[model samples]
Target: MKKLILLLLVFPFFVIAQDLPTVYPFISEGAKYIDREASIALEINILERDISTGNIDSNLLDFGLEVFEYYNKYGAISEDVYFEYLEQSEYGDSWLSCIVPDYVSSTLKSQGNNSYNKSNLGDRDPRTAWVEGADGYGIGEYIEMRVYAEALKDLRILNGYQKSIKSWKDNSRVKSFKVYINNVPVRILELEDRMGEQIISFDDLLPEGFDIWSAEDFEIKLEILAVYPGERWKDVCISGISFFGCYC
Candidate 1:
């Protein structure tokens, strides 16, 4: 009876280990990806097509090429690439302009000495966040932040805490999300669970470029379309969110 109980306890782990994809061994030096899981995933993702690459996220695809190129002895492109965030060009990184008041009407006050709050979002710290404990799958939760830049070009969102591996998976996080620019519907994207970080490009991508920065109250709103529940907490959280654009 004890032996049967032990087998039952360990069976799931044994099955999970087998069910996991084969982690192909490869090395990279050019693009030091933030998430090791994403690095290995990228290796499997690109190599599956005979190293020819295919329809994948452009940033990930670029990182793969950088690693491939570096491995194949390409130019001196040291630290020129990363998969976790977009390498902003033409202008410096965008700043946290301001948040539209009505959307973030209810601010979650800090608990004890723990410093996770809405204000931390603009502090430029991925370790901090504003979380809501509504119990539901984070639907109806949203943020409308002003993109205060000379030319608001793009938006980037980093879902969940990415300061550490344990913290990331320990809290509920966004899965599918929606975007609104200047109160106008823009796009919807399904985020990658392996420490999601995605950039939405508007220049040349949107019809007539959807330039809303010139508008009086230019705001970018993100709503929780769906969520992935945490292991120990029901609260939905976002580690970091950024705006990339021209200061000029």
Candidate 2:
């Protein structure tokens, strides 16, 4: 009888520990929610305040309750008061998070090892690359990705065939290029003959006078207009590529 009573008493602690709701990943949006439970009011209030001031270290007591001060605009700030959270300003999911390789293509193939083909561009590994094989460093050679994004805001390119620190500058790097969406020319970008990743960001990818969002079914083309070839090789290469914003 005593053992049964002790087990019942100990079970609640285990349950509490296991069920403490993680108070993270809350979308930063000014949205309100209502709950029937009064015990949770204080916890919500404290968390809401901390997050607003860029404070993430809000304490959750042993009771597994986040300590936050609730403020009620309509009535007394009580446990039953409705709460609001930060609203998300940015639209769409992360571009890199959910992108699928639609049609990542390059000009030619490396005859010896197909591993360095254009298909490897979306693999996210910098070691493998989309390299123009025996074709040599052709200025017009390009690496085009058929991107599908909700709102394309940022484009990051790990330029060059960077298998090693020494090999990074050993290939033709993109010096000037044109950006295309769905085969429609949008903008042209010129990058320095530099090693490492380069980013092209857009505040509003939508065309002028359009408020909705950018096109989702996009054919993003990175046509090599000019290049700075490496010391030894004359091959054009792109190591990695990633887009930002939500995927369609």
Candidate 3:
């Protein structure tokens, strides 16, 4: 009887421990041991103030909630590194706008006056998206960007047309992306078909002995390998792409 009770008590813990990697692959296993509640709370407060004063839109608020959800579900350590990255922004050591790529790939001319340019990928507005202009579902199409890789930590992607629920359902979303850093193939990211931001960590992929303070730059490319077909259109869309890191 005592053995049965012990097994019942330990089963859920074992399950969760095994499931963390599958659930939040962006969070490094090493970072799952550090606590950063105070830092996370501070960022939450800043986000709240920004949202209230109209300084920033509610997208950041939703981001904060997602971060809080990570903290809640995986405990304090799960998001400690992320919040640590955010803390640098407070002291001017980092800035959010720095995540915007210096240059983005060209868009197709057939997009017309709707302005479906590649620049929309980093505009921070979910309503806008970068649509691939290619024949037959744009299977081999890709988008590339150039950015300083000094403090780059993680990349966040908002998949599909996010202008409206109807639009999202009508446009294709990426299922697999072959990631390249400085033209060197690095990782293949598998994204979910659902809405909202998907984060991919670059911590483990950085070059050995890399220094964040250095001024090295890299060209990142995301080549679409597969997609979640849309209901109405064959266009594959991506709403936003942002990074989190420390510039200091």
Cα lDDT, model 3, residue 36 = 31
**Overall local distance difference test of candidate 3:** 0.64
Please provide, for model 3 over 80-194, each residue's C-alpha lDDT reduced to its tens digit, 9 standing for 90 to 100. Answer: 4444435333434555542445544445554555667777776656667888888767776777777676677777787888777788888898888766667765556777776
User: Which candidate, 2 or 3, would have the higher lDDT against the true structure?
Assistant: 3
lDDT of 2 by residue, 65-97 (tens): 222333323323343232222111123344253
Q: How many angstroms is residue 218 displaced in model 2 relative to the true structure, after the best TM-score fit?
A: 2.0
Off by over 4 Å in 1: 1-109, 204-209, 213-217
For all predicted structures, in order, the TM-scores are: 0.54, 0.53, 0.59
Question: Relative to the unseen true structure, what is the C-alpha lDDT of residue 127 in candidate 1, on a scale of 0 to 100?
Answer: 57
lDDT of each: 0.55, 0.53, 0.64
Q: Show model 3 residue runs off by greater than 4 Å.
A: 1-94, 98-113, 204-215
Best by TM-score: 3
Q: For every model in order, what is the number of clashing pairs?
A: 0, 11, 0
Q: Each candidate: RMSD to true structure?
A: 18.2, 26.6, 17.5
Q: Ten residues in a row with the worst lDDT in model 2?
A: 21-30
What is candidate 2's CA lDDT for residue 152?
61
| Deviation from native of the Cα of residue 183 in model 3, angstroms | 1.1
Evaluate model 3: give its TM-score.
0.59
